[model samples]
Target: MMRITVSFLPSELLPKPLGAVAPDGQDSGVLPATAIVIDVLRATSVVSAALANGAKRILTFADLEEARSHAMGLRDQQEAVLLCGERNCQPILGFDLGNSPAEYDRETVQGKTLCLTTTNGTKALQAAQPFEKILTASFTNAAAVVAALPHSNQPIHIICAGTDGSITGEDTLLAGRIVDACCKSFGAKIDNDSAEIARRYWLQDEQGQSLAERLRQSQGGRNLDRLGFGADIQRCAASDTINVVPQVTARSPMEIAMMR
Candidate 1:
């Protein structure tokens, strides 16, 4: 049996393998297994909702300029596309929307392709692309992702794209959920340094408050509150809002499609 493991970030800051120095580029190396990347504060959650709402596709771009160019090209053909993302925790100027799942509701995103760029999530996905396999994960699709984990003999890595290049409570807590789900579903245990740290964080959150409440207390959570986006945080923290798993396929710009 392949031993499953999880790694919560900010990679370099976390300590040991749990917090490795995040790779310089996408070529981190062969993972020899699977990796589920998470940015539960909003990115991954929004991606899940967008796809569930019938988004034609989501094109994640690390650079805002590039994403805009792509969107402009898409628009030139008269195709309906929406440009959305955030920078410094606020909506970028001239974007169709920010990085909020509520903004991606069915009526808004259906039949549209999202051109997205963010401070961390996009960069994290790009940096971790060298892994053998990558999956996008969030609380919205935790159960489905748990069931979808590759059963072949290979380790699994859960990479949490924390906020502003730092590990926030929400992402680490989400990683903990994945780690716990794995332990219950696979009857396997993890030994990775990161998994241990994530497990501890999960247990801490589970001790008193509900997941949503815990998320509301995170660093990103407070920022969202001050910015009047508190509702978005609650929405993202809701468990199983949608049942589809979003996977990052082997393609450019890293499209997120429903894993079915």
Candidate 2:
């Protein structure tokens, strides 16, 4: 049976050998066959929007200056590149674009490479380097990501990019949504307590609150709202709006492209 696990924070994850099973009958050592990284508050959503809008590719970095420097190098070589990302829920100084899905329209990002850096999301992606296959997911492309999963018994892991080292409701909700979809579509079993908690949390109705409202209550959402980005929260709350699945195709610069 395929086992699905969820790591609510990047710190909770450890490199595991592929296909390894612990004495407790859980995944241990190197990561599983596939790993899905979720940062619903923004980063993964931005990747989905950029790719769907025809951006050539996205290169993620953990440092702000490194991303800017890389973008500069690409521009110096005459490559079409855009420096994109955020810090403290606001645009990095001088970046061409902030971490907003709406900013990555076809006219803005088409045929251009986006060099992105974010506080939590890009770090989560970097931490997931041990996985065999790495895919990015958000509310915008959750169904597409589930549809792209390989049909096999190999264990799959979901890594949530939490806010400031703390698990946030938005990422957990999306992770739970994916877990529920995988359970329904592939008959996969939730393999950890975190996964079970997320799945159950997603199944509950929060007293008539809309998805956007729920997101606004999350830590990341509140920060964005304080930065006057409530609209971005609404955009991120929309589910399955984008059909593209962004997968990590290269590791040297950590490039993400639409899965082929």
Candidate 3:
């Protein structure tokens, strides 16, 4: 394995609420060729759909108060700033929208800026801040995100927005998909055991059960179900449904725009 940790390399890289797992057994410091942020339950999926539908930009914040402060400023500058986020899979009080992809329809989200703070996704973004390049992924846009990556044969890091500080199955599933995609696209090496395991998961049941069912089976998925948001899970798990790769690039504080 070209992956060696604590060789904790000279270069640095970066996740926040759904923080990246500690690189305990894997390479610690070497920066990945590219970092893939996964919040398969809803965050990245919603972002993909939001941008694809013409939403102006999504401003991510880990703190709800910070998001609120930014929302006020953005609203003052533009009338269309909407507060979107979740607290334990439910809408935050006084916010304009919940963290459901279906809620961000073209009519509501189009031509507007969404100030989003999710339980895991925004935290994941915070965690990935130091990364050279950050790309958001969800089953909803797996194929498109894979297609957008450079086939340069560099290491790809899949950062899962694990639920409540632990890995979630949905996030792993997409990471696996990305691993499989990279193997074919660039013959990328599976640097660690977790990455290899995720790849195997994606390989095991590509077409057996509906991805929605798999999502529903996850902790994040079941929580959504308990909250009567089963429909959101279906939307999140629909692979390749939206063909947008959300790349975080220069402009301003963590603004995600679809990379063409």
Best-fitting candidate, scored by lDDT? 2
Q: Lowest summed-lDDT stretch of 10 residues in model 1?
A: 13-22
Q: Count the backbone clashes (under 3 Å) in each candidate.
A: 2, 5, 7
* Tens-digit lDDT track of model 3 for 1-260: 22211101112223122233334655433344467788877888889889878888888888899989999997788668999999888899999998889888898888898889887787677666655677888887888887887665444667787887767788877787788877776667777777788888878954678778888898888888999999999888777878788988653568887785
Q: Considering TM-score, where higher is better, how would the candidates rank from best to worst?
A: 2, 1, 3
Tens-place lDDT per residue, model 1, 14-58, is 333332223453434355567788888788888888998999888
* Candidate lDDT values, in order: 0.79, 0.90, 0.75
lDDT of 2 by residue, 23-139 (tens): 468866545479899999899989999999999999999988889889999999999999999988788778999999999999999999999999899878877887878999999
Candidate 2 error regions (>4 Å) = 14-32
Which pairs, if any, clash in model 2? 16-29, 16-30, 16-31, 17-29, 17-30
> lDDT at 120 for candidate 1?
81
Q: TM-score, each model?
A: 0.89, 0.93, 0.85
Question: Candidate 3's error at 94, in angstroms?
Answer: 1.3
